[model samples]
Target: MAEGQRALIVSAHPEPTSFQAALRAAAVEELAAQGFAVQVSDLCAMDFKATLGPEDFNDPRDTTRLNVSLEQRHAWQQGTLAPDVAIELDHLLAADLLLLMFPLWWFGPPAILKGWIDRVFVSGAVYGRTAVFEKGRLQGKRALLAVSTGAPSQSYGPHALNGDMNDILMPLHRGVLGFTGMTVLPPYVAYHVPYVGPAGRAALLSSWRHHLRALEHLPALPMPRLSDHPDALGAGERAH
Candidate 1:
């Protein structure tokens, strides 16, 4: 049992009655049962700001210019980020496991969740020079995505019309989560959710519960390590 461990569930769905919400609830209950203290961020219910803008930084490093990345690093270091961003950052840093629950839209996450990444994953706090991939600030943490898709399961298969689901999710898994040094667990996806009958929905929930029970043993998806590409480090330095 992971007693005293913390889990953060960030749920993005406009409707509280949606399957995404149900998944979030199930995660909370199961994590709690596993002796984890769970924290929830219901973005829609909270009316979370879905944009990254100047307001996110109270003290800009340059008054005449607005470089989002540089400003994020500055705000993070100065402890002057917007309250909502700061609060979420705290939860993120404190979590042992982070679960992002949302419906797949346009082959990606919703705009709100993207905004959360933009605002909370500050440049300095989450990643910076030499602090990325295996050396990321979140290196010891784990992240999982619980997603619901409108398309049927077969459509997401390797040669299906819609393309492989893993490929579709590679950007997020590798670019965002893995880039920050979090171990990316294989995502849990419920396909054709809108068309699934009640029995199917129940079965998905049951499977999700089972998956959560074995979270600790789940194998991480492959991610690139900076050490493997020593040349990349100099390239990274040049880019910055």
Candidate 2:
């Protein structure tokens, strides 16, 4: 990641008036007010393509096709990327913290954000297949997930039809971000988004402000398995 107090906010909703837009706007504003540099990438506005190509599967360096797509090469010379996946990676690398805000769709993040990961979180870059204990380049950064959901929190409890919110998020935090060594802070979620009317939204905005303002004082993301296997954390825990 680049050195600086910067955050990258990714919004994947197709409509600007949708609940996601409002939440994303509120997050960026609050973070900005807290004196952090903020960048917003509205995936819909970018018409981001989520599909990976024939070449992405084969690491360009090792393959004859050179994994680098013509589009990526073109963007490289033009000094601009047409969502080649690396652009987001660059921002992720540069930011001190990554604040992901999205609407939960089909029990998880929307397609474009998932697509962003598919394209950018390349195998070699994020991890290694054989060396399960390898370190991630993003080790020192922090990550937080904020989401807006139509389902009421009441509907998500164990007593309710759906499972806990954490159930839906475990794969993301534990399997992905935490697996990569970026400290995964507790998430922020706004439920019943469709019903979180103007007044409720105002309240959420106030809370969001506090979340952003508290970043500096908050403890860094803990090294995974710090206590369960304290010695196993070895070098990575020290970075935190």
Candidate 3:
């Protein structure tokens, strides 16, 4: 919470005038007010390439073998990662807290954000054999997902039609962020966004502002210990 601490918000909405964009804007303002040096990566605005291919690496070990993870790791070690990936990695490494803002598309993040993770989170640079989960490369950093959903909050639960929101988010929270050694915060969701009126939207924005202001006191979602899952380690496991 120190003055000038950095916060990076990765916004994945395609429309500049969308509600997701407004939420991203609100986050930037609130974090700035709280003395954070905010940086935003508006994926759509940047026209960020979401696909990972040979172009992302400078030199491939075997031109015939197209292994993304291997190439990404090699690129990092050789300081030859694609410019975009390198830049994003720099932002992530410098930030104290990283927020991913996007609309929940079919129970997951937009392809742009997913692509960001695929390219920027290089295997050797970010995580490796022993550098994951509790001992991940970015161990001390924090991450949060601020998402919007079309369904009402009541529609999400163990038995509900949309299923549990927390369960739906476990992939990003535990598999992605936790695997990278970040403390994952509970998601801030703006549900039934299309149905909410101005006042409701305003209320949600207000709550978002409050959340950022009190980030230091917010409890991180509990993740299983490395020892808890010796079989698969940080791989697929049931949400706790």
Candidate 4:
């Protein structure tokens, strides 16, 4: 492991027997092999809370005092979050490369992970003129989505019911993580959960290792600074 570089792997699966844990172990091993420090937060094991409250905003528990600020209120569209989210807020601030490992529950993150986002990706920490991602506080930082899906990849197509897996997780990519300033790399989705046996799991982790190796030499995502904020350019001059 390196002296300062650390990767935080946050897993949100309830069952330790799950292949999700295997995926996490694979990522940790791969990162460690590259001499990167690794930290795992088995959120379910930690008994993570899944609700939000008023104190989360540093205000009294008015039950309706979500108005921490305009930005906070703006995010109320996601609903109120629990106060314990402060703990996650701290962890996120310290991590460099964050790996979110979870199962795709009903086409999205588990309720617990969503709550973590709700609480930790708070108004002040995640938004403002000067934010972690607002102006690139963590511009060089990276995030990867290691998700497990019960449905097959074909089922996630345009005509299928699952919808585009990438689109389904846009909240993590473009909304919370990217909006705060992190560069989201291509997600690693393990589809067809039912067919994932021990051998299949091994193959998945092997592929995961290959992906990690491919990224080992690259320090971070390749997005340009100005490109980080598409809205930064003039309305008429900004190109797609």
**Candidate topping TM-score:** 1
Q: After superposition, how far is residue 77 of candidate 2 from its true place, in Å?
A: 18
Question: How many clashes show up in model 2?
Answer: 4
Estimate, for each residue in 130-200, the C-alpha lDDT of model 2 and write its tens digit: 22222665677788888878888888866677888877887778777877668778778888867878988
Which parts of model 1 have CA positions greater than 4 angstroms off? Answer: 233-240
**Candidate 4 lDDT, 1-240, residue by residue in tens:** 355788888899999988898888889888888777888878899888776655454433344544454435444334433435655665677887889999999778999998777666666555654453546455566889899988878988667787777778787787767767887777888888668777887888888778777764544433334445667644543252
Candidates in order have lDDT scores of 0.92, 0.69, 0.88, 0.72
Higher-scoring candidate on lDDT, 1 or 3: 1
Each prediction's total of clashing residue pairs, residues at least 3 apart in sequence or on different chains, is 0, 4, 0, 6
For 36-62, candidate 1 gives per-residue lDDT tens digits of: 999999999999998998877778898
TM-score of 2: 0.77
Q: List the residue pairs that clash in candidate 4.
A: 51-82, 52-81, 52-82, 53-81, 133-180, 133-181
Which candidate number would show the highest lDDT if scored against the true structure? 1
Model 1 accuracy (lDDT, Cα): 0.92
